[model samples]
Target: MAKVKLTAVCKVCGSEIELPEDVMDGEITSCPTCGTRYIVRLKGEKVELEEFKGDVEDYGE
Candidate 1:
């Protein structure tokens, strides 16, 4: 299997989180800094760029 680069932003505290490739779909994880909760989803088989929109976009590029 290949490694996937996953990232998500904290809606509560505005923190950016970079998830590991193993962090699969339907998994609920919390932000390391602020403890904000989020769900890991797989919109496609490969990584999705459009997923990191809004607050999460800054840290990505």
Candidate 2:
């Protein structure tokens, strides 16, 4: 049997982002085109992507 691939559209660059078939919810995935990070959300048999926000680190200011 052949392995199936999952895909999602990038919200920033409108490109296709390939995902693993066993990808889990809350996993981080980035776009190759725009380098935008997204959080994977699995709802039943559907997959949803949400933009990820990173916390800024302070360098001893």
Candidate 3:
């Protein structure tokens, strides 16, 4: 049997974002075309992507 792949569209750059079959809720995924980050939301077999505006921590400093 062939593995099934999930995909979502990037709202920023209009690119297709591939999601893993085992993806969980609150999983962070980013757009390859643009640097926009998104948060994965799952509810009863429904999947949704929301823009992530959380602060980025700089550990290099």
lDDT of 3 by residue, 1-61 (tens): 9986778899988999998999988888888889788888888767789898765453113
Alpha-carbon runs more than 4 Å astray in model 2: 55-61
Residues 1-61 of candidate 1: C-alpha lDDT, one tens digit per residue: 8666677767667677788878667555677897665556668764222322334334434
lDDT of each: 0.61, 0.86, 0.82
Candidate 2 lDDT, 1-61, residue by residue in tens: 9987789999998999999999999888899999998889989878899998883232112
Clashing pairs in 1: none
lDDT, candidate 1, residue 48? 26
Each candidate's clash count: 0, 0, 0
Best by TM-score: 2
Give the TM-scores of the predictions, in the order they appear.
0.58, 0.81, 0.77
Error of 2 at 60 (Å): 24
Please state every model's RMSD to the true fold in angstroms: 10.2, 5.0, 4.0
User: By the TM-score metric, which is better: model 1 or model 3?
Assistant: 3
Worst 10 residues of 3 by lDDT: 52-61
By TM-score, is 1 or 2 better? 2
Candidate 2 local lDDT, residue 17: 96
Candidate 2: lDDT of 47?
Answer: 84
